[model samples]
Target: MFSNTPISANHFLIKQLPQATAFIDKNFKVVFVSDKWVEEFNLSTRDIINEHIQDLVGISSKQWENNILRCFKGKRTENFQENYTSIDRETRWLKWNILPWYNENESVIGAIVQAEDITAQISKEQKLEQVQFILKETNEIGKIGHWKYNQSQDIFSSCPMINNLLEIEEDSKLTLDEYIEFYKIGYNRNTLSMAIFSAMENKQSWNEKLEVLTAKGNQRWVNVSGKPLYCNGKYIGIIGIVQDITDYVIKEHQTKSNEHLLKTLINNIPLHIYIKDTQSKKLLANRSELDHCGISNEADIIGKDDFDIYDKELAQKYRDEDLEVMISQTPMINKELSQENSDGTTNYFLSSKIPLKGPNGETTGLVGITMDISDIKQKEKDLRNLIKVSSEQNKKLLNFAHIISHNLRSHSANFSMLLEFLIEEKEEAERQKIFGMLTDSSNNLMETLHTLNDIVTINSESTTNKKEVYLNKQVHKTLKHLNPLLEENNATVITAIPLGTSLQVIPSYLDNMLIQIISNSIKYKKPNVRPEIKLSLSYVQNYTVLSIEDNGIGLDMKKYGEKLFGMYKTFHEHNDAKGLGLYIVKNQIEAMNGKINAQSQVNVGTTINLYFNEEN
Candidate 1:
């Protein structure tokens, strides 16, 4: 890829600049990348040209993507310093600018990016922000000036500009002793001497921004640079420039303070902000996140992770996402996580996590922010359920209409036939048989009406006042209530509902569903087989599961299972099998936000599984 191309010679003045730079087409395909860009990223021209920039380099945040998009639109963005992890996995604070490159026709062709690593400078500034701010505000007095200090004479003097900047006498013959006193003690005195000495000894240039006490006893912040001056190749003096840069210093101070202000703001905000050190896996969480974990605001989170305070499953999930962010060195934005609420509901949050980098372009840690989107997610969930409920109700309504019309018509026809037989029959026995048939038809119609009424009642009331319905207690109550019927059938009931299996459901509805299911097992037992039923309860994910198994004369599931929960559908030859028990059980389950299913095989056994929403 680097084969004999004019650009391969590194024959551009832009290559001579210290900054790392590269140019890429609208497709993010590299066209011309400077040597410094290749060197800084530790890449070769063969690896860069025609390769997607992001594939060969590392950057985080959509802001970088937005900048590139803007450049594609022929706009220019400049001077935003951010810490980035390079392709070589080193972290550096880069100050960068991206501009649209123009073609011969003056149309935008591609984007040119330039960046300088300013990690060392920013790191030093941060460590000394407070002290530097104090010194600058208290002691800044000079403007741009020039001065000379003779090493042999141990003398210091300056022009009018320097004297004015220091607010001193222009003709004052300042000796090295007098000049030394002008530098405030500590860093100012020590640092200034070191810079000057280093410059003189090495015959090189040196610069420092420091504070000084003037001849008039007023303090000042100054930018001073010294160059070794030689006479016939022997060092004689140092020539220097002195400029008051107090305005720029104050601005820099404010800019640094904004970071602290940002931290304070984040702590107070409702959104949860979390940061974790990758090496230690220790979290630094804001007040909202701390509060979520039931921790006091004053408690330190520096050595803790999600696993330290959250549920194991939830913590594991979060830990995985944290690793994903750190590994990709990318932002995972607007991801959803749902947590159970104390009130037996669910609350969802949208979170974003991105890798945080250190000064040397290393992925040191990651930061994330999560905002509660419970209201929105709840609305979405409700909408989905409503749509499902609406469709189900529509189908049920059509089925109801068809069944009611056909069954009522059949009963009416039976009434007419029985009345006609009673009126026309000459024999008393035939009239008696017609009367019995009429009574049976009337009872059947009433049973269907009762089942329809139950369904209608359940469908009308959409709200449920749910509480913690303990499974073991409810199951025992159901079994105890039907003990007499079980005794008649010589049924043996076995239960293995371990402690603490509970659900969020309406008290009556929970009892009704269990009773209907458990009673069915006993009611439909195999003859001479000594009926045995097993009831087991457990918790999985966020649901409480209750399963009932019965060894009985099971029906052809393929023919009957589809309509097992439908109104007035029965497969067994039992006097009480109006087919409404399973229907009522299904409705009760759904009323409490639960689900039901059955599995059966002829002459073997049947198992019914019910899942209820567990209380959180």
Candidate 2:
């Protein structure tokens, strides 16, 4: 203790001190102070000597005061840190040290006090605490954790977050092998093992998405990354991070599955489905559309427009329609259209198109579907033709009914007159004559009945199955039957029908028809000229035409063309003309789904052409 020491010596010693320091007497008055003390307290050029410690520090605390008193009793006291107000009235932290000074007799004389301004250090520590807190919260929220592996010691260390992510207790410490067990078996485990090994051996870094099983047996996806650690160019350990990515991975998988399902549905649909961009270029096409466009691969049709696959005019039309739909933001539903093919056949389609919109409701493109309706069109046409045929048949039935009524009435009138004459006769000869007339009338009525029966039979049996018949053979058979008539008319018959000229027809009908027509040609021959008849065969489209031409007294076609094939219609006056031969022929031909027409010139010739369906 410098009780006898010069104050100047004490000042010299304290001034040499490199820390904020002060020396005080037992009465708690400062004896000398260091330059550091002045600088730390922000003091101007003024003396602070002989000042009480409380006055210099400007803080009133019983504990601080008691510590100073204890220092005077030869006890040393130290405060690591203390909060106090400075001379400027700003709050600050300080570290204090107090010790009793010793005299030559080893008795305590005064205390030496030292203080350190630690405000900056305290502020730094507080900032560090705040950063640590933020980091912990971030880890919990992001499902992230960090880990390190010490290669030399074979030790693996991880943060508490890792345990939480693995669904294990916070205090659980797992060995290297045990930690690996958390990775899902098979590919996930193998991948992590390989990545770690490679990182250590090659000093590389790796990042991978892998599956893991938690301690509670829950499946999860995780992103794992590792980098080899080095210290002084020597491999020390591996440091890495792991993040829970289950939600993200699952959402991605679901999106992929939905896309696949949509693609399959579109491709399997029967309609031709296609998608186009705002520029009217192909963006997507289903399998049905690819097949329709004769494309084997989907990629081949990408970016193509209608002009690439269709005629110029049709392509332009299609593009125009697409533009209209997109611009109007409207849907064209089930529009019927016809397309003519290169083969000169027409196909029908039912097409629909709708504009596609973006998220902001702007028109982005268009989607279209076209269905082939060619089969449906054919069915409609067949239905119309059937209705027309039914109407024509009804008209024919009405005409037949009128013809039957008129013919039956005539027969009945004749019978009545003959019976009256027989009843009024007075002599036997007269009675016999009336009876003969009655018999003749009865015969004529019976013949008319037979004719009616023939007509009825032809109509009823129209749908009978037909057999193949050769035209030349049938014509010869008919001529042989009509040889006597031909001889009477001195007719020269020429059979121009080719051999093997076959037709599917009712054999009996053809035979009867040939007899009626050829006989008429012979009966109506020019009075002075010999009759000449020619039978020829030809084809027109799906019909096989058989022409029977005759050089005889032809009828006036212009005058009687309307009733050429009408029942009970005769163009010329003749006793043998029953006005039934051509009508019967026409009915027979039609029953076999054939047609009949005549070209004639008076006194020149008549050609009766029969058209049979070659397809049948």
Candidate 3:
């Protein structure tokens, strides 16, 4: 230090600097240190002056030592930033400058070393670098970019991410007009233009989602956000960020379209479909379901429980079923539900319900589908009735066969016996008696044959071979033929049949039936009471009904109702009662696909109704 007296004088000046600095002599020993240098390095209790520079601050690098050695040869050396560690093992950043000091003879005497502690500044720079790295990574991964607009200069600048998104060259400078051209032509361009204008005029901030046409002629969706830049009450420019949102936009559009399609499909289906949440609240209902409930719009039913729409008891039943299905997480498929209406009719439904589950397989709600099966149920009932009727007809036909065989055998035996007797007679009187008996037997056989023939004809008649017969004309014709019998019995016939009242039937069969019915009214009249018969026509559901009321010897219905229409069944003991008229009439009516029922009281009257199918 004595070799450079001038340097010694300036050492005090060097120590007065505000920076944490140090001065060293050519021998690599620290000669002076500033107050800030002691505080910065935590060397207040240590005497570093005159200490070897390497001892105080370890400079282990060879290049750093060479630079310090060069200062002794009248050369200057500097390092703006270098790493260092103090003797206490404290790491720091330093700015170093080493220069030669001259004596009075203008020759190099020793070196001066100056150093500044730059650890805090270096730390701030490192932190800033790390932030920039993170931001760049985020922008690339998100397909996003930042942009700036200079309004006065009409300049637009964007980051590298924007260039990649647009599929254009990197670092391209664009004019305001050129920048806007990247937006799509119709809605996107117009919107961006207005946004820019508003931002420039009113200094407003805006964010918009818009479409862009890339340089490669591809379409993309993007979201742009902008904030007006202001400086000291003066509007200057705009800063904004843009993000590529093509994937998100496409997915959103597809989702909406699918929702619309599903809604349309469910609405058009004939079955009633509905969705309910765990709370049994209606979440969705299709058109059929809405129609069933007499609702015009599905929105009116949303978030409403069954209790809000249906009868209290019915709603409770539905809710209970729904809860059971959801709680069990099971599906009820093709379950037949029958409801008894107030009118004593039962309505049927084919219903299905499935549990709706969450992502973790927990029950969330249920979806139900129901179809009205009342028509099908009615058809089943009709089929069962037809089967029963067919079975009964089969049984009656069997009985008829047995009756025919028995009657034919009896007639044949009587004929053989009478002929045998006639051949063995030896007297004329006996021959005459045999002849009379033969005649009577022949007549009886003929009558039985005719009756059998009639039965066979009625059963074998073709149901399709039917013609429209006016009831009034037919009744009149039958009465005209029976006028003699009617006069003898003093029987009166009254008719209230309409002129055009008609029934589809076999004409010959209908004529025979009318004759039999009118004759019975006359023959079975009470011994002292003149017979009175009334004929009328009326219409009932799906049937044209003809009713005949007779004031005659009526039988007790409770005793004979079941056998009234049976073959060879007779309630009266008249000599003319062959027990076949009502049976034949019933068969003929059935052959025409009509029905007959009778109501009667002993010694009072009888009313017989014939139902003819209107459709037939």
Q: By lDDT, who's the top model here?
A: 2
- Arranged by lDDT with the best first, the candidates are 2, 3, 1
Report, for every candidate in turn, its global Cα lDDT versus the true structure: 0.80, 0.87, 0.84
Candidate 3: stretches off by over 4 Å: 1-34, 47-116, 158-168, 171-173, 225-240, 297-303, 331-334, 341-345, 352-366, 375-504, 512-591, 595-615
Residue lDDT tens for model 3, 521-586:
777778899899999988988888888889988879899999998877887777877789989989
Error of 1 at 215 (Å): 67
Q: Superpose all Cα atoms of candidate 3 onto the true structure and report the RMSD in Å to 1 decimal.
A: 9.2
Error of 2 at 590 (Å): 3.3
**Model 3 — which ten-residue stretch has the worst lDDT?**
1-10
Q: List all candidate RMSDs to the true structure.
A: 30.1, 9.1, 9.2
| lDDT, candidate 2, 483-588, per-residue tens | 8888977889888777788889999989988998888888788889988989888889889998889988888888988899999888787898889999999999
lDDT of 2: 0.87
lDDT of residue 240 for candidate 3: 79
Please provide TM-scores, in order, for all candidate models, with all chains considered together. Answer: 0.38, 0.60, 0.61
**Top candidate, metric TM-score:** 3
User: On residues 564-588, what C-alpha lDDT tens digit does candidate 1 reach at each position?
Assistant: 8887788877788777788878877
TM-score of 3: 0.61
TM-score, ranked from best to worst: 3, 2, 1
